[model samples]
Every structure is written in C-alpha cells, then in structure tokens.
Target: MYFIPNENLDPTLNLAMEQYILSGLNLDEEILFFFIDRPSIIVGRHQNTIDEINLDYVKAQDIQVVRRLSGGGSVYHDLGNLCFSFILPFPNQPVPDFSSFTEPVIRALRTMGVPAEKSGRNDILVEGAKISGNAYYHNKFGTVCHGTLLFNTDLTVLARALNPKPEKLSAKGVQSVRSRVTNLNGYLPGIKTTVEFRERLLSEIARDAKTIELSDADLANAEGIADERYRNPLWTFGTSPKYTLKRTRRFPIGEIELRIEVRDNIIRDVVFFGDFFTSQEIDPIVDALRGSELETGALTAALRSIDWKAWFPTIQEEDFAAFVAQGD
Candidate 1:
C-alpha cells in the first residue's frame, strides 16, 4: 500500500478527506490512504449521538467525536491505532458487498503473522478477540469502508469513549460491552509501537495499490466540503432525521415469533413468543434498533444481518418485518 503520511491528526479533517475520495472515485483511480491520528470517537450514520457517546470524557480529553457516513456502532481511534481508506471505482460495477472488501485487511493480517478471521459478520478477530471492526458508507459515487486496527492503543480511552446503553448500566460503571472486546496489542508479544505495525500493514495493502497523490485541487475540494458541510453543527449534532415507529408483543409468523414495539426507529417494546433466546445484551441491540429510520427494507436488512443467536434467537427476517409492518 502507498503511504500518504498524514501530518494532520484532526479526525474530522481526515474524515472529510475520505468523503472527498468517495464522491470522486474515477474509473482508473483506486487510492489507499494510510493516515495516523490521536484518540477520538467516531459514531456511525444511524446511531443516536447522545446515547452512544460520553461527551464529558471526550471533551475533557479534547477528543473529537465525528459522525461517519456508515451504519454501525461507534469506534475509538488514536495514535496507537491505524486507519486505512480505500477509494475504488464505483461505476456500472456493483459497489462491493461489505464482506467482500474486508478480505484485503484479513489478507494483510496474515502477512503480519496473525491468524485473523472475519467473525460475527463485521469483526476481524485474532484468537477470538477482535483486532478490528469494519463499517461501510455507500454514497452515489461508490462505497468507503474504514475501521481501526487497535495495535498498542489505549483501551481505557475506548472504555471512556463508548457510553453503554441505559439498560446496560447500573450504579457502577458500564457493565456490558466491557468484557467482550480486547486491545489489539494483547496479541503481539514484541511489537511495542503501533507505528511499526502500521507501516508493515501499509506496505502490504499498497503493494499494487496505485499511488495517486491528492492534488492541491483534491485537498481543496475536501477542505471546502469539510468547512461548509461536515464541520457544521447542522450536519453534526443537530441534523438527525425524525421518524415514527411501532412494535408488537408476542406475535407469530410461521414457527418464529416476536413481542416487539417500535418508536422513533427503535424497538420500544419486545416480547418472546417461541423458544428463542435473545441475548442478555438485548437491550443495547434494542437501543440500536430504536430511533431507527423509517426505511423498512434497511431495518429488515439489519435484522436479517445480525447473528440472531447472539441477540435475538431464531428470528426470521420476513416474519420480523411483517410483524413490524403489522404494527404500522
């Protein structure tokens, strides 16, 4: 991979750079940017900004919390973390499926002596612990999928960056989402520097990646886009779209069932109709499902995509959508 060596550490600025590349993907140009940065929290497109992040901790630390154009949970990025962005052509060609593009990172990890496997749909795990998690943004131009390689980063910062859903918290600190994840460096014995790991991974991905340096005009486009749109409060904390939702309690379709209600795009209520076991962590999944947009198809898409056993047990997509539609 060709390294661009970003001297810029501002997360939003780099994000604008990525968005610029996504909007302008040319037929012959596929660029890979290896940018470095300080610690910050990035929220996914459809997430509730207030519910998923700790503003006090982030602000106290001077960390940036920028919303990405993708759909998934928030993630932490820092100096010890490495972020890779791919700007591939999106033409008559179908935008690559989320899993298809993840292969490059999986392949790159193998080059680093880690037996990294794509697990639970969106995570890259080393010996069952996630080394990385990936999310995608689909724009009119094409798609951009980016996530963090934990390396030797600060897990404490990650812990602070993420705010556990209301149902997951007690009088104590966050009780869930704390144990399942592990830092990336826990897998590496001698590697003490994230920068070294970053360089190695960069070379692997850019082995054949074209080095199309961003021209002054290109950065200018990104700079303009950032200042006028991305950095604005209207697009930041003030621009969440609104929608009404409904749910059903203990309803059945074929052999599957759900007792669910939704409001503001979330599962406002839930009921178990069959032998299915939704997770102990079901509340967060419910929180994520709440305040969800009115896109019925995408709602069904997220439902169908999850590991039902991990959250909802034995749920059928068609049945769930039909149930939700019935609530309407």
Candidate 2:
C-alpha cells in the first residue's frame, strides 16, 4: 500500500484528485490518501444536490457544493473534518462488504481509545454517536472507498446544511439528528488541533507505509478535470434525474400544493391544487409556468404579467415567485 499526500484544500480539486488516482490504478498496488476541504457539502453521484441542500442557506453562507463519484447520502465537510479514501484492487470476496473497508478505520480509532465501532450500514460510531460515514465506488479496475471523519467539525452548520427528505429522516429514526453525532476531539483530550488528530489517524492507518509522490503531469490532469467537471455547476446542481418538485404552503387565504415536473432545468409541467378560491380559471397561470425557466425572477415576471388577482387576490406576486423558486 502507498500513502499519497493531498496538498489542496478545495473540495472540487480533492474529488478530482481522487478520480485521477483511481483512473491510474494498477492491479498490484493500493493507495491511501486523506484531505481537508474548506466548508462544503458533497452530494452523492446519484443524489439531487438541490434536494439535499437548503439552497437559501447554502447561498447565503457561500458554501462550496460538489457532486462526488460515489453514491451515498450528502455529507458536510469543513477544515475540521478529515476525508479519507482507499483505492484498492477488486476484493476477492464474492459479496462486497463495507466492514472490510471500514475495519481499518475502526482499528485506528480503537487504538486511540475512541471506542469506535462499525454501526448500521456504513458509519462508525464513538460511544453510540456517529463520527464517520462511508461511501464506495467500483470499476472494472478497482474499488474506491471514501468517507468523512468528524474530528472538530461545526455541528451547527452541518445540521442546517443538509436538507434530507422526510422519508429519509424517518427511516433513520433521527429527526434533526446532528445532535446524534460526536467529534473525536471530544473523546481525545490530548489532541489540541484537528491537524494533530489527522496526523495521528494517518500514522495509525499507514504504519511504515511507502510514500508516493504524484508527478506534475498527474497534478495538472487532476486540476484540469476539477476545472472542467467537478467545479462546473452542471455537475454540482443541474444533473439530477427527472423528478417531481412538490411544495405546499399555507397562505392566509388557503393551503396550496404546487407540483412541478422539472426536466433539464426547465419546468415541463405544473399543477396547482388547493382549497383556495379563484374567480378566473387557473389554467393560464399553470400554462404560463410550463416551459418556463425554473427561476424566481422569470416566474415572478410571468405571474405579474397576467391579471393573477382574478385567480389569487389574497397572494402577492412576490409570494408566488418565492413559492415556486424556494425549491422547498
């Protein structure tokens, strides 16, 4: 096994570097690497970034958002959080097991007296509180398993950043569950800084491991990939599969449920169902929203252009705009 050092703190660059290394995999060698990124939220390859985040909060806080190569739930990372990756040749095990990939981490934590154990499907818990979450990706050449380890992360920001669906929250049986997570710093009184925690963890995992250096060409390729793909908004926020966006709001007038089928960043269809009273037919308003850009300004202008008071006298144009663009 070889230990590769990551020098960049950009989430996009780090994810690009992981892919770059994974693509250059040799069947005989495995590589281990870890990095700390600035405040960011990384969504799984199969997840909808918009659906996983509070867009208003993310934008206001200016947090970096990116899509990762592995499929798993969204995770928040900051300088206090450490992310580790292992790119290894295909395992001989017939049925892939997460434990095989996570046991090393568990061992490392246990050695530090953290009492870490593999819990549920793909998480490491410290005294029944989660400290790590893992995700995996497999290709013809090898398997890449990577995850986040919370050392001294800002739990408050993490809680507000991820906007999981009701079903997912209920399934996990923990609503507003950031409190269920614990940081290694709390357990390791000896460690003064996150940097210390990272070095110690790496030391435990990479005992007498060979250090490998990436050539300039390798780095440039990774940077180029980051700029062209990982950093692009299309991959981060716009590549979600076709999905229905449902938003329900209780206006002073009545309750309204807005259902929209969005495709390729366009509103393909829209329906408004509610107990709200209207004098004129709402078909025109629905048609106006159809084929329109899923943008607040455009939707607002469209609504303002029509005599919408005949349909919804109690609501304001800005409210309609906010409702459609809120992405709730």
Candidate 3:
C-alpha cells in the first residue's frame, strides 16, 4: 500500500482529489489517504438533500454542504473529524463486504485500547455508540472505500445540522442523532489532539507503506474538477433520482401549494393549488418552470422573467423563487 499526504480543509477539493487519485491515476497497487475538513455536511450520492439536511440551520451556520460519490446517510465533519479512503482493485465478486475494509481500523483502534467493533452493515461502534460510518464507490478503475471517524466532533451541532426523517429515526429506535453517536477523545489512552490520533492511526494501519506526494499538475487538475463538479449546485442538489415535491406555504395574501415533479434534475411538471386568489391565468407561471432546473439560479432566472405579483398581488419574485427552490 502507498500513502498520500493531504492537509487541505476544503471539502469539495478533498472529494475531487479522491476522485482524481482513484480514476485519474493508473495504479496497480492499493493507495491510502486521509483528510480533514472544516465544518461541513457530506451527503450521499443517492439521497435527496432536501430530506437529509436542515437547510435553514446549515445555511445560517455557514456550513459547507457537498455530495459524496458513495451511498449512505449524510454525515457532519469538522476539524475534529478524521476521514480515510482506500483505493484498491475490485474483489472477484464485488459484493458489499464492509467487514473486510473496516476490520483494519477496528484492529488499529484496539491497539490504542479503544474497544471499537463493526456493528451493522457499515458502521463502527464503540460501547454500542457509533464512531465511524463507511461507504463504497465502484468504478472502472477499482473500488473506493471511504469512511469518517468521529474523534472529537461536536455532537450538538451534528444533531442540529442533520434532519433525518422521523420515520428513519423511529425505525432505528433512536430519538435523536446525539443518542446514537460518540467521540473517541475520551476513549483514547494518551492521544492529546486529533492530529496526534491521526498520525498514530496511520502508523498502525500501514507500518511499512511507501509515502507518495502529489505533484503540482495533480493539484491543479483536482482544483479544476472541484470547481466544475463539486462546487456546482447542480451536481450537489440536482443529481438525485426522480421525485415529487409538494410544498404548501401561507403568504399574506393566502395559502399556496406547489406540486413539482422532477426527473434527472429538470422540472418535468408543475401544478399550483390552494385558496389563493389570482386575477390572471396561472398557466404562464407553471409553464415557466416546466423545463427549468431545480436550482436557485435556474429557478430565479425563470421566475424573474415573469411578474409574480400579477398572480399573487402580495408575493415578490425573489421570495417565490426561494420558496420553490428551498429544501424544506
């Protein structure tokens, strides 16, 4: 195994760098790397962002939100969190054998006197509380198994940032996010800081691995990818599968209900219903959204072209656009 050194805190650049190393590099051997990000929320590839996160809380806190290349529940990260990734050849069957990838970390933690064990499909638990969550991404090159370790994360902010559905929480028999997770700071024997814990864990995982450094060209290419894909709102919010969104809000004029159908990130159909009074036909407003993307910029442009108050005399274009594009 080869180890790469990374110290960047930008989540988008970190994710793009992972993709660059996995798909851009021609590798015959396995590679391992670790990264830490500023306070951010990383969502799964297949999850609807509107359902997985508290949009208002995240925006107010100035937390960066980005989607990963793997499928799993959303997770919150900060400087106290440590993330690791392994890029290796695909197994013969390519089944989701999470134990094979997680056992190493569990063993390494055991060496530090932390009783960590694999609990469910893709979680590492310590004393029955989750400490790490893992996910996998497969491509033509190989498989990328990445996961987050909660060393000393802020449990309060984590709970406030993630808004898991009530059904999901009830299904797990847990009332809140903080009740299901724990930090490793109190469990470590002598690790004083997260950086020290990272070094120790890396040494334990790959004692004899060769160290590799990325060149300037690799950094530029990864930054380009970060700006083009990870930083783009379309890929982060509009990449989910087809789904219908029904939102009802009350304005000073009256109540308005919007039912929007989206497929492949484009608005397929829109319908308006409620007790609101409109002097003009609503077809023009509905027609404007038929082909627009479900993003802030796109929806704003589409709605700005029309006179919103002409339909609902008290509503403004910007407010209506935000209501249509907001994630609950």
Highest lDDT scorer: 3
User: Candidates sorted by TM-score, descending order?
Assistant: 3, 2, 1
Q: What ranges in model 3 sit over 4 Å off? A: 89-96, 239-328
Error of 1 at 195 (Å): 2.5
Which residue ranges in model 1 land beyond 4 Å of their true spot?
1-5, 25-27, 166-175, 239-328
lDDT (Cα) of model 2: 0.79
Candidate that beats the other on lDDT, 1 or 3, i.e. the better one: 3
Which residue pairs show collisions in model 3? none
Please, what are the lDDT tens digits per residue for candidate 1 over residues 180-225?
4566666566567777777677777776654556788988888888
What residue pairs clash in candidate 2, if any at all? none
Give candidate 1's total backbone clashes: 18
Model 3 residue-pair collision total: 0
Models 1 onward score TM values of 0.70, 0.72, 0.73
Model 3 global lDDT (CA atoms, 0 to 1): 0.82
Task: Say which candidate scores most in TM-score.
Answer: 3
